[model samples]
Target chain A: MSVLPLVALVGNPNAGKSALFNALTGARQKLGNYPGVTVERKAGRLALADGRPVELVDLPGTYSLNAASPDEQVTRDVVMGRQAGERRPDALVIVVDASNLDNHLRFALELIALGLPTIVALNMVDLATRDGLELDAAVLARELGVPVIATVAVRKRGLDHLREELGGLLDSAAPEAKTLPPERDFDAVRGEARRIARAAVVRETPSRRLTAAVDRVALHPVFGLLLLLGLLFVMFQAVYAWSEAPIAMIEGLAEAAATAARDALPDGMLRSFLVDGVINGVGSVVVFLPQILILFFFILMLEATGYMVRAAFLMDGIMAKVGLSGRAFIPLLSSFACAIPGIMATRTIADPKDRLTTILIAPLMTCSARLPVYAVIIGAFIPARDVLPGVGLQGFVLFCLYVAGIIGAMLVALILRMTVTKGASGGFLMEMPKYQWPRPQDILLGLWQRAVIFLKRAGTIIFTSTVILWVLLSYPKPPEGSAVSQVDYSIAGRIAGGLNVILEPIGFNRDISLALIPAMAAREVAVSALATVYSIDAGDDEALLERSLGDRLKDQWPLPTALAFLAWFIFAPQCISTIAVTRRETNGWKWPMFMLGYLFVLAYVAAGLTFWTATALGLS
Target chain B: MRLTELPLRQPAFVDLIDWSVLSPSEGQRLREFGLCEGASVEALHHGGLWGKGPIACKVGRMTIAMRRNHAAAVTVRTGPDAAP
Candidate 1:
């Protein structure tokens, strides 16, 4: 009869709130966007001890309700009952790091002043004890006039006790809990919070801090940069090496399925659609899933181990020189997996100019979708021998593609900062979380989420684009005994023919042009489009030798053209989802249009230059 | 001395923070993180390629990363009177 009681978890940035949320909800969580805003709304179902199912929402971490960042603003608004789409929380769980009580308590004290029914979760007590901290939770509860629970969210310690506390708090049509902490100025409140924190701590032993020890090596100017680069190189190499067998297995399965479809269906359009469009088309995109998953695995691990912020710390000076802050580095690194989320992540950067510059340059970071395009091209043209002792030529080429994107993004950011988005950059401020062993369940959950997104793309967007491409290439059958190939007479070919006038100068053949249009929907669709076109073309000329898509490409395209195609993807800005997200993030089409124009010009010139240089070098 | 000028690895007490030198939001953020007067502080490390970039300061039990320019507004004292 009543709406599910909404309980929100709130905390500072590094207070282990996410781990606690995962522990409480397990896999029953649902993620969506808060209406009218791009911030994530994460909610899950939690069954209280009284057999009542309540909604557990995880609010973004913030230091205070002062609304410093977009994330913090959302957290403040949701708790204050003014957020665009969220209802005011029925109760609040204020999570604070056990070791960092003095700083975290400032916010907790402020939240207590909001007069909401509240509980303090003394999270990460295990880490605190490891750091020689001994705290009395009873003192904290007594001082704040609310219940306090010590929890190690990652280890699932004290969770049942936490649940019992939650049940009791909800059971009382508890007389509206009055504001316990008195109103005071920011400084006074913080000072009182310091007093409370001191009272709660029974003893503070000076133990060898694991964070400082790790920071000595990981943040050393020379050694730290080297470590970051080395980790990246190894990750790229592993992406290519570890996923090889799985990729081969997927390709074999696709071939067998296509063969079965051809035999099961009659000789008509149904057979062609199943085999050429669904099988080979979407199958080409699906084959790259292993590489994407491997890439995400390394990223998630870097994030879990608390090394990502250190990477930003190391990059600060260089980023400053470009009129940006080190905070931009995290989003840029994430753009390697996808531009949509990377653009969304920019909300944490406070300055408008800096956030805009970061968004404009994000698409240049060779996204995982671009990986399939580069992999096929390099496999067909480049030699696979060891270029150096441990560097294979193919992997080196892949790494070069990634570097090209990074270099291009940096240059673009510099130019944009000096021109369209020019302004004084905002200062960087953040917490450096302590180093700890990454939990297996957290990493697996992250990987599982990415895998689901990848597969859904393969099923929906890739499938539809492939089917449409098949139809466009299959119709308008060429006349009997005619010299014109079936493609030349089809609708898609004529469309490519019109566009070839502009693209031919860059060494892009008609086939590449045909693949280009469909790829605008999503970057990975280009691979499927090419596979479909080639598969359909193969069926037309029965006398042609049967070959894999790579073999077909190698036989047809010149080395210069292949290299030019690879160069184009480094700066290509055609992903529809990326553009849509940019629109939502910037709240206008102006920046996205500018992004499209600049990237298009850059891609054309880069492809043309690669074509000319490779041809000039006698590699034609 | 301003916290930025405080010698590395030396423990000091925050004396006076010129909040006027910082933007409202930046000042509020610093206050929220407990980098106020009478708090114990130490400059841990300087990060950047050239080691002239942002300074990592220990304010209470947390390590806070802040740009050099922002750290220049907070005055600190390192004598016996600096003890909390």
Candidate 2:
């Protein structure tokens, strides 16, 4: 079997490089971290028109070979074949936006100077033509001494021509390696790019006026800020409102499956494991999938429309005041979905101090993993009555929890910036791509990718952990004559009994302490852990196991305890993956350890305060 | 006048950049973003609640937000007769 030729897709940010990669790769893709950094390494399989298979690597977007941020460094390293454990790419596919040829041609020239077999993918030609730009691909190809193929990545137009050209290149001998000239004067490069662009592109009409009109309002100080906040408010509300029916259906399905398993399997350890452990435990966490998807839907739409960059511009002042650049906004906002990606996104922050500070506070930004815990608690305690004519009381509590997390993260960022990571904030110079209506296909693909990742985590890690937790709570057969339940005699119960000494002050009971141990792996697992623990404690009461976990939680735990648990989750460094990512990103245990220590202290103090205050208010 | 002091939406031509006020890399980055001498610039918006924060400027086709101190390093000629 001949080794497949490696093709790298490279371009500047917002060049539709990802759209092209997705169009080419479809479902045949793999995503992982780069050799040492947390920046994602995405590669996919592409079968050419001539029946030749090629490996396509989607390199991180970069403006130049002069790497400033870690993301750009990864791109440069991969292109130079200097990245560890990565082979040199055989061919380079430079995806350039046709509407903005001059802006993109500079980077294309840099890649061309590397002397690789290169193909220029003139992406978004549809948008370019609509904007009254006439681009001659043949002229561009001749000028750059490379094949130029017009492509509309979103519509999959001209992909066949792109593949055919790539196939022809793959069949030929590898191009001789060449290095860029030692002279790094970008002015010359810019001049050459302009010269080439002038010959290849003709602007029939000015493209900036329409975009400028939109920016007049979208970038307005008062109106833009209000619009951004309104968008965010709608997103949070939609996560609850749009997902309610689907969540209830998922919960019903989980309960029905658990009951069916209970009836099909005879009374034994296998039955208990399948019904009580797997279905009840993992099901509780899986039920929150709809909420996670709805949240990502809004995020993906925002990203697709290019408003995310404008958001960073809007928040730049506040972020700068807190000693961070506007670049930190994207990472922190992404943290609302998950901290691991949020931390990885920080690679775009040029300054080491700013990046590190951003990573430290990322976990406090209300990740989707916390949604299950929050949903269950809010569903149980917070009444269903509307705070206003339209907003439910439960959703309002959830929004408050999210706001609390953001506040906690901002305060921590300020402290870290002022102290350990102290340094002048870096530049906030970033491209604000023109807005376009989000393509349904692109948004669907993004949502699908997020759903797969979440379900995979639920099926594997959550499934395995739940089984292990079941054993810890189910075994060591209580003395046949003993009045105490089997859970009381189990190893997990013993451990929780000991840990309760510390947890008790925070209003965490023995069962809650038991859940906390497994919750360390993933925050959402706490809900499932509690479900399994309570189901086991119910002892032969199958009906209790089938009941809604929220109802069970409300009956078992007091108001103060539930509120304290929510408080702890807001600040707790519960996700082990986040900690692991922190270690990898910082390249040491020092920062991760410090993060864990501070978060632990914060979680404890906050939970204790909440518990005490609620008790004082007679909420208990 | 400093680019920071330029009126919003008024076009200006950059005359000089006080590179000494900024770190070498930062100055290089600013130039990379097309804020070099002879580049046309317009202050698009001022950020923050009091509108005295980072200034969003159009340097060529790119929209960039820079701190006041950073913007202060670049001198821009704002007269109607200033060269394009």
Best by TM-score: 1
Please give the DockQ score of every candidate, comma-separated: 0.81, 0.52
Fraction of true contacts retained by every candidate, in order, equals: 0.82, 0.40
TM-score of 2: 0.96
Clashes of each: 0, 0
Q: Please report the candidate that would top lDDT against the real structure.
A: 1
| A1-620: candidate 1 lDDT, tens digit per residue | 77998999999988999889888888888889888888889999888766688899999999988787778888989888888888888899999999999888989988888878888999999999999989999999999998999999999998888888998898777545442335578887778888999999888899999899889888888898899999999889888889999999999999889878877888788988898899889999999999999999998888888999999999998899888889999999999999888899998888889899999999998899999999899889998899889888888889989999998888888998898998888888888899877778888888888889899999999898888889999989998998988788899999999999999999999999999999998888998898888888887454441478899999899999999999999998659999999999999999999999999999999999999999999895
Deviation in Å, model 1, residue A154 alpha carbon: 0.8
Error of 2 at A341 (Å): 0.5
**lDDT at A256, model 2:** 86
TM-score of each: 0.97, 0.96
Ten-residue region with minimum lDDT total, candidate 1 chain A: A174-183
Query: Can you give the lDDT of residue A327 in candidate 2?
Result: 82
Cand. 1 Cα-lDDT: 0.89
Q: Which stretches of candidate 2 lie over 4 Å from their true place?
A: A179-184, B78-81
